[model samples]
Target: MVAEHSPLRVGIAGHIHLAPGSERPIADALRVELDRISDRPVHGVTCLAAGTDQIFARVVLATGGTYEVILPALDYRDTIVEPSRADFDELLARATRVIHTGYRHSDTAAYLAANRELLSRADRLVAVWDGIPGCHAASTDRTVDEARQRGIPTTVLWPAEARRADRRP
Candidate 1:
């Protein structure tokens, strides 16, 4: 068992829209990778966006770790959270802490700011990327690059077949 004093802080970054038939495998892969990277279950820092962020939070909770959310934009729930997956609210509510970044929503700036917060606070980054750069500014590729530059140990969970056939989202 890992020492109680040393908890692993894991921040998640990945595609918001996951390809059909890919979510379970990706989550399993992420959990396995996180386990391999650290001796203990991890505390997840999530923005609770939709696909990837929510999955990481679930895995962290399943493994006996807590999670915290950082909202990048103002009125995030009113704008972005509504369209997210169904479990988003329950997960958000269950988060150990919630921080709303004062950055108002205007373009992708909010997400970018939240992503930065995730990286800065966590000891490790868990990226569920498809090895492709997403269209948005807060893409998984960009997150990976930032983590690398920050010298944060990262565990990227992208199975060979998990790559999306198309990047429509």
Candidate 2:
């Protein structure tokens, strides 16, 4: 149980490629789940990737909550697409704090380490996953598994109409 005086620290693990037009519904689902979690002030933790992480940060802000960001690597910003760079930069600036994983490259190892760091700081996790098992360590499934292993309460949001895009933004 969370201490009465502490704000809930919620983490996110989700897909980078989400279907077009899925944003509104997904945001709604997040809002609902966040409400169910607690009325205590929220402190979100995310990597601020495109799609889900971006949406989660916005929702946290909307609810008058604060959030921190975790960067996967020193050069992680370079991996963001040019079109989404502005959003990423904006969210990064809005974060109450930022933690870097100390990796030199935005590779699989860096991402896994980043997620681990995120999980370490979080009291619970929100997974915008499709319930599909992943083949690799970087997938949403793997992150959820890690959270469960740590005994972090996890809420999975997969709206009925939610779909994933064929490519990354």
Candidate number of the best TM-score:
2
Clash count, one per candidate: 0, 0
lDDT by residue (27-139, candidate 1, tens digit) is: 88987887888777678899987788888888888888899999987777666544564587889889999988788773488888888998888888888887877778888
Per-residue CA lDDT of model 2 for 1-21, tens digit only, reads 778988899999998788888
For all the candidates, what are their Cα RMSDs to the real structure?
2.7, 1.6
TM for every model, in the order presented, reads: 0.88, 0.95
Candidate 2: C-alpha lDDT: 0.92
> Which pairs of residues clash in candidate 1, taking residues 3 or more apart in a chain or in different chains?
none
**How many steric clashes does model 1 contain?**
0
